[model samples]
Target: IELNAFVAYQREREAISDSAPARQLFNWCREAGLNARGLEHALLLRDRIGAVCRRLGLPWVEAEPAGNPEPVLRALTRGFFGQVSIFSSGLRG
Candidate 1:
């Protein structure tokens, strides 16, 4: 899912071509239990969806972690930094 999402992202950014990953993505998604119609719909909207995800800084979890939290943390921070708020204060006003 992550790999396909990245490939779709690249395609949306014009860094890759739409046809490049189609077969592999379809096969992988099929094996992962995604139906044909769903895949078709996703592909059809890949450009728009991918662009939106990119613009919104959404995380795609691109790699498999081996008991490591670094990658996941990085992705999350990059994606949600703008939306996360941290406040430090004392009880007294």
Candidate 2:
């Protein structure tokens, strides 16, 4: 994710843990030579979805603020990290 966007998310969620999932992901992107633009777009899309859900009066469960997102992020990474690229590409195509 965009470093700025992730940092903003971490701050907004009060995610003050040492886990640093966003940092790790950003580092992985850099190491893998992936562009930050894609991650930034994803983060922006997340924001837009949250906004739309609010506007439409739909429950956006994941938007609930939490003190830490490490556990969730870690679990999701473990479960679907490998499939994310394929899933995203599928969506684009």
Model 2 over residues 1-93: C-alpha lDDT tens digits?
A: 224455554453354346886676566557656655675676788799899999999987642354357655675697796798888899997
Instruction: Look at candidate 2 and tell me the lDDT of residue 52.
Output: 97
Model 2 deviation from native, Cα RMSD in Å = 10.8
For candidate 1, list the clashing residue pairs, or say none. none
Score candidate 1 by TM-score against the native: 0.24
Q: Which candidate is the best by lDDT?
A: 2
lDDT agreement of model 1 with the native: 0.56
Q: Pick out the ten consecutive residues of candidate 1 with the lowest summed lDDT.
A: 84-93
The parts of candidate 2 lying over 4 Å away from their true place are 1-28, 63-93
**Each prediction's TM-score against the native?**
0.24, 0.36
Instruction: Give me the candidate number with maximum TM-score.
Output: 2
Error of 1 at 88 (Å): 57
